[model samples]
Target: MTTRFFLTSAATTLLAAIACGPAHAAPDLEAAQAIVDEHSQIPTFEPPGEPFDAKACMADKKLFSVPTSSSIPFVDGIETSMEEVAEEIGFEFQQWKNQAQPTQWVQGMEFAINNGFDGIDLMAGIIPSSLGPQAAAAKAAGIQVFATHWADTTTPDDPAATHSFPIPYTRVGEIIGAWITVKTEGKANVLIIGSDDVPATTPYRKSVQATLDKLCDGGCSHTYVNVPVAEWATKIQTNVQGALIADPTINYIVPIYDSMSQFVLPALTITGKKGQVKIATFNGTPFVIDLVRQGEVEMDIGESLGWIARSTIDAEMRSLCGLDVPEDLYVPLLIFDKDNAETAGVPAGFNQGYGDEHVSGYRKLWGLE
Candidate 1:
């Protein structure tokens, strides 16, 4: 119901051209490699020189993590991590997933403040809402507020944000874009399904365009469709099918968030364009990984759900305890394709999740091992 359009006449002129329009140019493997090599490395976090008492820090402390929609598999994974970490560290963990409407995000913060939580992790759900006042108010009340997956989104003036923010989302887009270039061998007509409601989509789209400019020089053309979170289920199907029909040359379909597979893939099947378009996405959900395993989808870039939970909790504790913690904790990003999905991507029999390196790693760093 909250699906909003980027343009008024989207139906008639859905293809709002970007600077790096999709061109079916010759494959530029060189460009793709250069990017891969340049951004291949991520930072690693180690314990501080002077240690603090984590057990003491979390003593009698309660933390609340709220996601916009816990029903979404990816969000659910993060929410699950919050709970698991809370149990390990001995703190109360809770979630407020009212899927609030309009300014409800601010309202929820007001509610949590009154509830007397020590710290709150505001997940990506309310990044675009009026959270500045709320964040400042929480800090004034001595409540540490940390946001994951949305820490550096459209909110330039982010509140008392943690430096422990990991997940380089911009880098993620570039990796996917580079993959498309190498896979298409240069000429990729890409249909990018994005959500403008989530401001983080802006940086990701820019990175994708930059990759297209480099590798898609062989005449790569692209069309971008902005679908808000509220309206994805009803609108993604119709809009994607329309885009595919509008331009049958589209060989690659990139969903900024792969969870769109829930709605987008069904649309592909309905329109009989299943094999016609390939899908590569961020957030390697188990469902999408299955698609990769079965050769239903093309590529998936995934981070460990358990690891992210650990890193997020690490950041929260550091903030609440006022320790000198590193900013931008590096979370590893793993890419999986059909060819390597079984052997190397996710490996066999491990489900779609990553190992618990961070889980144990954080334990040692906190001296809680």
Candidate 2:
């Protein structure tokens, strides 16, 4: 495990205090709006490193991926896209379908090791720490285990995986904070919802809380609540309802992950706060982006699945081929709101709107174009 990736006990305590800290008196609206404007544009692809013979490097390599849940559209999309990339690169790719269970993940790892796979990737929301022995066994068998789109770049990488493609989740959190500040003109009252079980959420929440404190100062206020993944269906709506009842002034509900928006939408409708309180979340999941178009969600931070697939493949191939792998996946984030939700698609399409900069850029880097 990289020491830089894990938070110390003191740092964790400090971040907790900051996240729940009291509000200040005024907000720097200008600064908040500046952040919103800067991040709202379509992001371009920047090469993570100099070009290499990715196709050659990937020749005869076998890759398998196990997602947290095959049912999740976001995770499904990325894995499906990865398979497509592997096909184009002329390497064998397989997916181990599972229902977000650690046992299933262990089975997937065992399959990869026994079947002579060159690499295996544990996709979003699947914690590596929970599979320590399985991961160690795979590494022992010379299978390079990877955790992709799981932990944030700021958090320490779990030693279970040989490598990880840390996503910029904290940056997304900060962007959400800025959007909230700008939308409310610096006096926003927010209900911040998250699942503490997801390792990525720690830095994500920390980033949002820190951004709100710096940009809104004491002008903005928020209440934080934890709804673990298993309890989201049963707890999120009621928890949100109770919070709204306690504080009618709350105008924004920010669930760290967009998938949680499903439960939150019901809460808003039940509380008659549908139009009163808006939602903004991470992940460009099509349905959630559709919510943005319908006015149910105010904004969303999007990372195209196709781009993520290419970036993950690029990084993994580099590492496996004994090239220097990037410290993090260079996936670009785009913001979707009422002004631009239609560009993603009238009803929103998976992997649409983010442009093909990655497609062309990666092809060039891989010497495919």
Candidate 3:
């Protein structure tokens, strides 16, 4: 399935309205509005002390000729950044999807190595066990490794696990918790949902729990619901339906990612409480943005644009070019709600951008303009 990225007119209008409104709106709305305003503002960077020649970087023939493998298909922000990077530097890029499975991650890594790619952009879903070995094999093969959307298990001691960046999972959790507490007035009975098996998701869970413990003085009530990898949709629908049926008073629902929230929507419908329950999800995909606009989802923490993709490319390109590498790099985060979801650029699922203008802003930061 092809995924297009872009912001919508509705989102733009919503942002404009929020921008004109008072700063102290509803907590969720205010937080979302702040993000929109921040993104819209141009940064004033200090003038370069040394003349950094973009042409010099571009003229590096080795960088242009390097072949790289991306962990996932070019569909979302990752793909968009990769395309822009490739276009700017003229590198040959290949993409492989692990289908959100552990086994596929191993296969994809092995395939990239065998295919003689200079670097690998590992975007596999969070599977800790698979990551170490894959990073090891890639390092052993001397292939540059860049990872996105997944945590890197490689420590300083492990040569095989060298040069990786992780998304700020803990920060994301904290952001979600802060938004939820503000929205629910510190009295939230939240249903936190995500896969328990993946190590990457564990930080988010811990972060949310920690934030609740620290921030909610009265002690916010919450339940961690593990969504099984297989039959997740069916299970989420059933579980949420049962939860609502069992306790009609339940108010808050927090999904780690918005795509997973789709499954729980049916449950809310079945319980005849679709709009009554508040939802705060991560990843401001188009669907979640619509839910927020319609008041179904109270808030969301948007994944930063191009950060994941650019970090992945940076890791691989640095390795290929023999540059100094860091152990980990983290992408920034954006919080979204009804007020700002439309402004921050909604995902493709919401029929927003027409592709051309979708990721141009973020791509511009990477010198992909």
Best by lDDT: 2
Q: Summarize candidate 1's per-residue lDDT along 40-76 as a digit string, tens digits.
A: 3332444433455678788888887767666677778
Model 2 C-alpha lDDT per residue in residues 8-123, reported as the tens digit of each score: 99999989879978636677778878778887788888899889997888887899898988866778888888999988888899999987667888899898989999998988
- Each model's C-alpha lDDT? 0.71, 0.87, 0.58
Regions more than 4 Å wrong, model 1? 1-27, 34-52, 100-104, 151-157, 160-166, 343-353
Worst 10 residues of 1 by lDDT: 344-353
In model 3, the runs with Cα more than 4 Å from the true position are 1-77, 128-135, 152-160, 345-369
Candidate 3 C-alpha lDDT tens digits along 8-72:
99998888878876333223445533433553332322211122223244353222111112221
Model 3 lDDT on a 0 to 1 scale:
0.58
TM-score of each: 0.83, 0.90, 0.72
Candidate 3 shows a clash count of: 3
Arrange candidates, best TM-score first: 2, 1, 3
- Model 1 CA lDDT for position 263: 82
